[model samples]
Target: MTSAAAVPTSLLRPAVNTAHAARVSVLAPTNKAHLGNLEHLFRNRGAVESTATAAAAPVQPVRRRRQAPLLRLPSFLKRARGDVAAIATQEEQVYLSPRLFQPVPPDGPSPRGDIAAAWQRLHGADGWRGLLDPLHPDLRREIVRYGEFVDAAYGAFLARPDAAPGDADAVRVPLHDPAYRVTAPLFATSSVGLPSLLALAAPCAAQRTSLVGYVAVCENQDEVRRMGRRDIVIALRGTCTVLEWAENVRAGLVPATEAADAAPSTGDASAPKVECGFWNLYKTAGDGSPSLSEMVVSEVRMLLKKYEGEEVSITVTGHSLGAALAVLIADELAGDGGAPTPVAVFSFGGPRVGNRAFAERVEARGARVLRVVNAHDVVPHLPPRPGGRWYADVGRELRLDSRASPYLRPDADAGCCHDLEAYIHLVDGFLSSHCPFRANAKRSILRLLKNQGANVKQLYISKAVDMRVRLDAVDMPGSPLGRLGTPPSTVLECVH
Candidate 1:
């Protein structure tokens, strides 16, 4: 029942545990019952001999309980039961034997044939039509990839010792995919007088602005060809400072056209209106710096011109408050009539950003938005739409349930539910709404474990410890223990 605000800031950021690497390196076994013992083995290395001896001494037998007699059902009743039993069996297997402890293969799920040929569908050209139901493999990979970009943005922001805006290289975040190079770092300033946790030690002037994110462009020709187009990515991080969190709750709607560069309003009650806080964050500027909108628009225009005559696409991605800014950025780029390529936004756990008119404007601008929402997450339903003030979500939604993944606790806190890592984990394991978490999901569970902290059980760590012990015993040339390869899938089970 603990609120998100009560959660420490360390939980929000990624934790670096030196032992995690050693723990995860040996997590390849398939048995779940030995998990607890494995955890003990790792934590107490001296107990290994005692543990092995204890395992050798186990020889207990249990009495079986009497079973109830089967009911005699009619032929019609048998036919009506058709696949129900089969589905129940499958669900049991999936839930009981999750892939939390399995090692991620060197190469993940096979590439979706040729990504170039299906890039449009993957980019939400047709409103994602059939890609979301079963969750296409290519789209899943792309979602995780973009989610990492947002994580990188967060890393860059937190790495800064001071809040002052720095050079492009200072704020540039290293990405997993080296195909894309960060072109420029983006900074945003707020005119609103709000306190910030980040700049409490610095001057008030330095606290007004900080590095928010960056713009990256695909420079590797091979990657460009594989993707079917040159991709320009604008990845933004969510609210971290106290000032931004305060802005998040300012749900009052204001005219989007109040800014000089904004699209002209029709001067009517139906005019497009955006959240006042989001607008101020986007349009506000420091003493001499350009606003977030200016920096993004200028950088995007430069990239579009630089990559002219080539097949190109603009992808904007973010989480939470960043997601709201992403929607606004997409609206601006698509409506400006300056860029000729398709613009799309991939939003994770984003709250409502505008009213009905603002949504229509975004659609009219031809910007495609796909909102990935965790059903149990409270952020997506935030900035609530009360009776008088209107606030409408503006995107096609792909909903996920946190309860689907056995790796996650059923009673996870709001922070755990809203964590970007959790969103990526859910997307990676997603199959269909009717289906359980995919057993062969390729995303590593280590990240989830690190983020969920006390929320997740020790099953993941225990499995790894068990696998290491088994491998060392068998793989060694002259070991006393005989070879015991991975256990059968039938014995694969999860402990809570």
Candidate 2:
């Protein structure tokens, strides 16, 4: 009997195309009688049989080059079942670092309801002293939730520039992204409070209408409401336009105010010649002129006058551009001595809004400030915080480590890290272990991950490309592989 190894080398290793190899059907022993027919067909069709089947051929594992593990693989695939020896490898594979921020101790008690309720509970009679208490898990979670609302506020306000303060449903035309389906309103005006103040950018011919910021009036419950006490939350939307970027680039340092009696300058001229973007934003109106701060001051005065002789607590909250506005609004409201006293500001991803003198004025107002910063967010590092007091951040800071966030990776594009949704997602993860909502929260997060992936796959790239097509799709400069800043519809994707 001739050995199988004695077959001709050409016949043994047929010239089969790799593309067609996986598609070839297996032949059964019963079909051996038709070998002659099969050979005749192969000859006629210009096809070659691959004796070295893909399954039969030994595939040598490609050596993993010594480099940082770039992609975060699924947890299940990282380790072997019951294999203690793989622990070290698995540990090295994890993309997350230890928690960067510690849990703030609880205050006197946890607040209830939505962001409005939490605001009312935190900022009571004396001042923001209650709010400045190391954030209770309850307050933190609520603030994080409100962060999403603040994000939604931009879309909502932009959708209905003409929306009346009483028209809650009209204001919330309901965009699908970020997905805050807030139905019930604390009052018809403000969703979950008294009324809302929507501030549109100064009219620009380039853009028809733009919403720069808004104030949500969260009243303390009926007991406090009857007493006419209300907590004001001012949320500013971040830059969504090239026009806004132009404002950011106009970084010449200026006095916080035009008044000669303005707050004393910090007197540190050695610092960079950059001014706070927030001050320019505050001074400038939407029409590419100056008036936004004046509008905010007017609205605040109206609210204060409406609730005269009653205790009022105002807390300014915003992300990115809105965050800078939040701090400035707090300073404005507290400075007038007519709006309210002891204001508090919670700023997320806020750029350095003003010079040292500006920050001092905000601080002097007795406003309690908490600047919530996420690790890797490029916004906070802006207006550039170098040695001297050129542009400076004002307030206490709550730093969060987003390295383990599901929406991010160790090497995620830094711009995606600047997203407000990403910040909320990180905050939710921080509260998951300690809060009652953990069980439901985990399910929701998993669903979000799955849905987010599905949504991204529906995009043009995934629909058009096959496995054979390399995913070297262009990544814009200063952007991540999948997340592009332009064309707002782009999805976050990372292809290896």
Candidate 3:
């Protein structure tokens, strides 16, 4: 039997050569870093037109439990049966514009009234707090303490009991390729609250220079558990306590430079981490304002203690909704420290976030939030808005999906995708595009340009390319600051 791993990234392309890979120019690659970088700006701007409803702090009745995370393969495959069957029946994949910043219609015919009701059923998002809200006050407090614990333990771990591999500031980059020098940043993945995602990154966190993160697309705990197991079945081994989205895969090593001994500087903690796995339940566009606001605030607090004086490898990645969340989160982290650090945010179908205001925020933060979309999944395009018609000034939607050919035969693909890993990818690739991580890319790019020069204008990258600022637009000496920034889209401003 042909394993899915046999398929290379290029195999997913179609005969039309319209895949996102083709449109995304290397030099013109849309930067997905700044979307949430300006989250700090938003965080500070409590005065920015607060809505009257702001005072009505809505609450939910559902109970909040400590969500643990993963997926066991046999069961994982069995569970995603319905979704898999759905994908298999489709004949082909579909592609949409990659300009992710465009505004979604606040009021439009929803794909399903039930989904809208789902939003309202949970007290219009209040109920979700019990189900998936990682920002629970207790959780936030735990996260803060956890960050502190991680910081202290990590420092001691690097200090070592008897001997260490290298300097405390410098460590080996774990890699399959011996040729590679620095240790690769590991990814922890879980569909829901699988503990493996937490486990892999958790152990890595023991290293002061390591970065640990997770990606949650499946809002259900069962799904997360299943995903945790399947991930273990894929790359990692043994009994892991947590399953993170990027737990197994590691981005290229963070080159240990001569400044390994230098103390870390305090960048703005106001930037939030990528969106939490719990946000799959967040369906309303109106929630963006407050939800994102809270995320920024929580992340600032978490990071304040976690990264106060550390030289850890900053990694950014997530699946489905998480991937999108990572987009904005990466922006904030990158801007805090110097250098355009590479934090890979591999998203599966994410959704739109906000106007150019958010995109500029992403640009200021250094993030390359790479988004991946499966072609067969219709969820990516769901919560359908009017075609290029919206009430607010939104940015562009990035690529529809990099892998669209599979959607051409949705039935076949969806049928075989019964595993939690497969299901999470399907849900993310189809359903969630407003990944917090991806949402901020454009804003970060624009902010980078704007901060450098007021005359900064947004350069038009290809359609497949995200609408965020391209690195080529920056004025850095060694970098590709060749292109001049363009003003906001006057055309879109004139139109819907």
Off by over 4 Å in 1: 1-113, 161-163, 194-206, 258-269, 387-389, 461-496
**In the order shown, what is each candidate's alpha-carbon RMSD?**
17.6, 22.2, 25.5
Candidate 2 regions with alpha-carbon error over 4 angstroms? 1-135, 157-205, 219-229, 259-277, 285-290, 431-443, 446-496
**Model 2's lDDT to the true fold?**
0.45
Residue 471 deviation, candidate 3, in Å?
46
Candidate 1: Cα lDDT at 383: 79
Query: What would the per-residue lDDT of candidate 1 be over residues 312-370, giving only the tens digit for each residue?
Result: 89999999989999999999999888546788999999999888889999998899999
Instruction: Quote model 3's TM-score.
Output: 0.26
Candidate 1 Cα deviation (angstroms), residue 94? 10
- Per-candidate Cα lDDT values, in order, are 0.66, 0.45, 0.26
Residue 143 in candidate 3, Cα distance off native in Å: 28
lDDT of 1 at 264: 23
Per-candidate TM equals 0.71, 0.53, 0.26
Q: Which parts of model 3 have CA positions greater than 4 angstroms off?
A: 1-313, 337-340, 382-409, 412-496
Provide the lowest-lDDT 10-residue window in model 1.
487-496
Per-residue alpha-carbon lDDT of candidate 2 for residues 25-132, written as tens digits (9 for 90 to 100): 121112222222222221222111112332322222222345533232232222222312111222211211111111111121222323322334333223323233
